[model samples]
Target chain A: MRAFLSSMVTPRALALSALALSFFFMMTLGGPFYYLAAFVITSVFSLLDMVGGQDNSDNDGKPWYYANIQAYQIPFAMLWFGLIYAWYLGTGMSDLFGVGGFLKTHTGFDMFAIRARTTAPELITGGYCLATIWAGFGTTIGHELTHRTWSKVAIITGRWMLALTSDASFSIEHVYGHHLTLGTPADPATARRGESVYHFIPRSTFGQIISAWHIETGRLARKGQSIWSLHNRMFTGWAMTLAYAGVFYMAAGWKGVIIFFAISWFGKCYLEAINYIEHYGIVRVAGTQVEPRHSWNCNQRVSSWLLFNLPRHSHHHAMGDKPYWELNCYPDAPMMPHGYLTMIYIALIPPLFRKIMHPRVLDWDRRYAVPAEYPLIVEANRRSNTADFINNVAPAE
Target chain B: MFSKIFGSATKPATVTILPADISFIVEPKKTVLLSALDQNIKYPHYCRVGSCGTCKSKLISGQVRELTDKSYTLSNEDIQAGYILACQSVPKTDLVLEVPKLRVE
Candidate 1:
């Protein structure tokens, strides 16, 4: 029975369930409660993580199952965008192909009435939900598929998913820029010690775009093509984002445009927040090999199930080609004190996050930092106004 | 259809590293750098994701399935000279590579 239950509650099942629940709640719940889908899902998963404990079992699941699950997100994400556009269209602009009227006639469901009654506070909550869904579904799957460099289908789908958050450049910068320069000062995604999530968001947001632009231009230059051409991925990606904004504009006018940008910006900020925590305070000497210890790992059961095992990040960095299901739990890597979602909540409050994480960083310095890395760690601490624990230490000769 | 649904079975491909006089069989679907590392042959590598270009080697002979675009890291001259990232290249046939960074005892 235990074995059967374990097989039934697989990661693929959990991911599919998340999509189904999100669809059901947002579709069925009218007015204010429509916005609570993401919040409820995150809350349930976070609670489960805290109670269910860690799962370090080897993930020997079939690759096709996980791949299909990720592919399913493409249609669901498109439907999510379509639903939001319709909601924004409202009673004032659109009858949504008279589906609203049909429902009103047949089911007495008053869709237009619900839209009319939705308050500003309700819309704010709706925006937050949109951000969460975008971050959770779009970014994670996008990150996975973009790494599949060998497949054209994967790359196109992945870029479109990231384009939902106005982050298509991530497909270029993350694989080429951040992966190469991670854990060093050169990496824009790597948060310096004592850097707040607030500060890291803007710095990383702009830094990634600029880095991606340079990378695309350089690639084009190698191919003897102009950056001004449509072949420039940054240009094409930005065009896709603008097209999305155009759809939102058609849906709800200026207000719809504002809401669209709001969701996109919030989604980008959430990605940066994840980045801020993933490698917070970890340092490595430039040109040194990126090892498992460079990334912080989490093995919390619920978070692992919901996140498609992104918590096994250290192994991902060590071997990028391995599918998400194949990512191994590197037990010796530096670990996060809480699940990924729980850590994101803690990281929001800068002082509290530092208070919890600073000691761990110091411990990493003592145990994980090689002799060559001692000076780099010291300098990082000094520059970031970190505690004076490693201040007096000199580089080992 | 089975291969499409589930990945194809592993078939070992021979890899010969020149200058260091190293030879290894790259397991099916495994990148050359990883296969070398698996066999305890220290083929120098930093980021295995074709980013840092630390694992760039001259493909002396044989076909390879390049996983990621190498233009981001390798120079035009290097590409013209047949350099490929071992970390991103899976041997499609028996491969002979000139790895300048291969650590020799």
Candidate 2:
């Protein structure tokens, strides 16, 4: 009974509850103010950084409930999408083809009345809530599922979730390109030393799409398929994005399309903000094996619990196939001074972020970087235009 | 250890490295690259996903179940030559493979 009960409340399982809470919060509140309430829920988790502290526990044995944990999120995510858009459309059950009038006749709960109550400020707050929840929940699950190369269902579902954020190509570039090139100059996702989050966000965002395009085109060329064909994942991803926008357009007309783009654009930026945090100012030689030291590891309990142990990034990069539940803690890896949400909040302020992170970067260079990487580290520092690489180096003729 | 000595019902497939003749047992449903890594075999690998072709090897004999499409990373010529990504390949039967390079590290 103890084992069974423990499995019911594991961190991974508990993480799914946030999605449920957000879904219910929006559904019950029935207007734009629900988004404000949802946003407050997300903010409360940010305080977990200080309150929850660190979790260094190991997930050595797999429980029976493990297989269904990730798969279950798909339904919640899909339903959340339907529910939020229904509220925005003010049609409720009407969008469900014939069921709309049938339900409206039976329940007499008019969604048209609720839509009248939604103010512009409330809608703007809804956009913020949509972006944050989608960024935090949708992308985290998407990242996990896309890595399940063994399951085609997982890949498709994960890609669709990412498509909502205008980053379906993450499945390709992240797995095929960024994972292989991480912490090197070739990795666009890696935030270079002295580069602010504002600078990193756009560069990483565009760089990833361009990188995914090259990978997809090269793959298609090898298979003797045209770039325009259905086999082209890049085009297919864009099609999925369009299909989602079409759904919005049909429901709420031009206002819906505008809101959809707003949600997607901000969600993409939030996703890039995560990328900015993971490997900021870290460097590794191009050919060397990716070790635990390459990423900024955060084991803060609340972040780990909410993000599905994504905060344990050192283990994720070291073993790409390992599930989030099984990601081990590496105490020696470079530590993030704050939890994931705190870092994202801090990263938004460029000057403050630099002041906090530059010292840590220098410490990493001194303690972790090997002799072979000195030249690269020195060159990176020079290019960053912040501090000089103060460590002594044996000059070669 | 007991499972190895007694031999489990779902028998693990044995992979014999070509020329070098180093043999290792891959547990059922485990990928070749990961099983080899578990035994501390220096099977040259960078990205364990089917993304990098670093773990590409010639399948001299035996069948394997590929987790992802090898054509994404492996060249057409390499695919035609029965080259598989060890990182993505799970051994189905006892196997022999020609690994191009084994890292000394």
> Best-fitting candidate, measured by TM-score?
2
Cα lDDT of model 1 by residue, B38-82, tens digit? 888888888777788888999999888887788988999999999
Q: Write down the DockQ of candidate 2.
A: 0.65
- Tens digits of lDDT, candidate 2, A1-112: 8877777775556656765666655654556656655556457767766688888887635463664565556547654654455445644433534334544578876555
Candidate 1 local distance difference test against the native:
0.79
Clashes (backbone N, CA, C under 3 Å), per candidate, total 0, 1
N/CA/C clash count, model 2:
1
**Candidate 2 stretches greater than 4 Å from native:** A10-19, A38-42, A60-64, A90-110, A388-397, B1-10, B103-105
Task: Score chain A of model 1 by TM-score against the reference chain A.
Answer: 0.90
Question: Model 1 off-target regions past 4 Å?
Answer: A1-19, A27-30, A38-42, A60-63, A78-82, A93-110, A388-397, B1-13, B26-30, B103-105
Tens-digit lDDT string for candidate 1 (A268-359)? 88878888999988888777777889999998877776677888999888777777878888777899999998988899998899888888
CAPRI-wise, candidate 2 is medium
